[model samples]
Target: MLKKELPLKHIKINYDPIIDTPLEIIAQYPDLYEQKIAENGIDTIIYDNDISDNVSFYNITYALNKDCMMFMNLPLEVARFSISNMTDYIIQLLEKSYYVQFLCDPYWVSNYVSYQKEHHEHPMLIYGFDTVNKYFLAQDYFDYKQKTKQLVSFKDIDASYYNSSFSQLPDEYQLLNACVLHCSKIVNTKAKEINCDLIKQSLINFLNCYSYTKVETEGIYYGIQFFDILINRYHNDSDYVSL
Candidate 1:
């Protein structure tokens, strides 16, 4: 197959581990995300993985709920290509200039350098692949290291794919927890350059939708009011009073 590729888009916000995968995938389409944010006054957040158990991200931050257009946490099927064998499907996505994110075991994908049979689920954005050469070009982000884009062998990818803990649990070769985003739907949103004002407003919006009752019992505090409380306490401390 002819090589298909797209430029990677770097994320702009302070990264949060809970939502990093979806943000990185969305970052690949900056124009679309920006346009939506400008016009709709919100980001169209979508998730394929069930993050309901992530109480902080889902309930407090509203990352998965606010401005959500659509979300499904079920297995996805493509009519043209089998999810079990994504080579053809991925190539087609590349041909159409779509970013394809795949879930794989880090151990096999990195040739066991990252770990030994750890089966940790990781997301990789595949941009281009050469069928004749039997390799694919992809990018990955790690918290402790700089982001990287590298070419990996098809055999290694296949091994990681089939060996993913998500797939092995069912004893079948499948794309586990696969999610694809279509941002074109909200592409017409007004584009506003990110600034301090926008950041403040986004925080306000987040606090408005979040229910204090749910997290208040858990001792999770946030927002400007909480900040004031912290500031007052700091000022009252004997250490600061002497200073």
Candidate 2:
């Protein structure tokens, strides 16, 4: 008989001290970091300060699934710090059952947190992502949202490079193409297990077909997929999964 997929149990967290520690030193002892999370309830820790924006925190979140606790310091709003670099760290340290909470605003950076709370999903957030922006551009609907403005807007140089990089990904690996039929079933079933609309939408988004005809809908669809993949990978890893 095939082995059954187990529920998530814990999450692993990695922090980039250089980037996350803040120049002022948030905690006297490194252990204090973990202690704080414990005070709030969390598990596992790693430390780093350099990463890439192309990387996604959801990757780490999914990898941990519901098996472990994960934590990290809030990403800095300063331009000297790299979002991509921070993203890389987030992706590497994800775990299951662990919440990757940011000690930041809820409105701009709280979508992941909101999704988790609304869904009782595997990954949870203690804080939210930052929403302060240094670059100026024509304001759009997304710009009106602090979180979106912070998370999505990029420096012109970074934006061009990222667009090119995304364009080069294999069609199968493209955000929309990552899911196979089997993965879709796994996600849908898991969403029910979690009893969350956010999780359900996330699963649906990941498995959606990429269609040029529905560009606007596809964007929303892709966003869900992005987070779903992050949660799924973090939660479903062998180290976190028990037989």
Model 2 Cα lDDT, one tens digit per residue, 1-243: 111122332323222211221111212223432233223211112222244211121221211222122222222221122234433222222212122222221122223333212211111121112225422211112222232212322232132223233233354323211110000001212121222344445334433422223234322323244435435544455223210
RMSD of each: 13.8, 21.5
- TM for candidate 1 is 0.47
The C-alpha TM-scores of every prediction are 0.47, 0.17
Worst 10 residues of 2 by lDDT: 177-186
Per residue, candidate 1 scores C-alpha lDDT tens digits across 57-118 of 22112112222212221123322212456566566566665555565566666533464544
Candidate 2: where is the Cα deviation over 4 Å? 1-84, 95-99, 110-243
Candidate 1 shows a clash count of: 3
Best by lDDT: 1
**Candidate 1 local Cα displacement, residue 206, angstroms:** 9.5
Model 2, position 67: C-alpha lDDT score? 18
Model 1 weakest lDDT span, ten residues long: 180-189
